[model samples]
Target: MPRLGLNPDHLALAGAELADESGFEAVTISRVARRVGVQPASLYSHVDGSADLRDRVAMLVLGEMADAATSAIAGRSGRDALGAFADSYRDYAHRHPGRYEASHRRTSPSPRTVDEGRRHSTLSAALLRGYAVPEPEHVHAIRLLGSTIHGFVTLEFTGGFAHSAPAAEVSWDRIVDALDHLLRTWPTSSTDV
Candidate 1:
């Protein structure tokens, strides 16, 4: 019999907190059950297992990040919008490194849809629309933006940019400007000369 007031959402939410406190790798059913003051077996009723719980946590984090990014970039457009989006993403990644990692995890959407990724893509597409970017160029532009943001952030998180200069802020601004310029004049098929 399931415990009264215990549920999947409660367990998943608690697991998310555990992830924040101990890192995603440390999150486990046993640990979560202990944190929740429930027997480890009790958790099985709410979650199928570790993978299901982890996926739920990932989805929650992704949704939160999407919401934050969406709110941050609202009422903005063009480079301003892009800057807001990029800055917001970096901020979220820095603040919630574990959740940020989960947000970008490549997984086939089954019970957990990556709607947050879709929302983010919408924002990126909107930015591309402002640039008049066409077909493959637009897709490439979006990937470029995503890669630039993720690459910088991931490297910084892992101390890969330890000895660099110009500061993250300066580099970030320059990157945004570079992206803006790239989007504004996305190289078409005939531009390879």
Candidate 2:
């Protein structure tokens, strides 16, 4: 029987906290069970194994990031929306490095996890609406937007910019401004280039 008062959420939360402190790689059923004061076998009732635990943590962080992005972009548009959206990712990565790392995990194909993943794309698409991007180019715009933000955030998080003169924040603002400009003046067709 499942342990009383010990649910999947509890386990996932424990896993997330462990990940936050020790790094995502440190999260394992045995380690989590030790952190939560339970035998490793007890976790089997809540998670399949290490992969499931990682996926749970990934889903949790993704949901948090999506919610933060949603709130950050609310009542905003265009460059404002773009900056706010980008800031949300940067802030979350800075605040929760371990959980942020887990967010990149190849999550299982559970419907809930899949839906949670879609929230990011939906949020990006909504933000894109403020720009003058053509409908046909929305996919490319979304890919570009996600790649730029993710790349910068990952680099900044991993100390890739530690040796730079201008702080990462300076470059971040410039990148966002450049993106806003690009989106505003998006080429409608290759012939226009």
lDDT of 1: 0.81
Q: Which candidate ranks first by TM-score, i.e. highest?
A: 2
Q: List the residue pairs that clash in candidate 1.
A: none
Clashes of each: 0, 0
- Segments of candidate 2 deviating more than 4 angstroms: 190-193
Worst 10 residues of 2 by lDDT: 184-193
Best by lDDT: 2
Tens digits of lDDT, candidate 2, 61-167: 89999999999999999999999999999899889989989988988898988799899989988988899677778888999988998898888877999997899
What local distance difference test score does each model get? 0.81, 0.90
Tell me the spans in candidate 1 whose CA falls farther than 4 Å from its real position.
Answer: 190-193
- Candidate 2's displacement at residue 72, Å, is 0.3
Alpha-carbon lDDT of model 2: 0.90
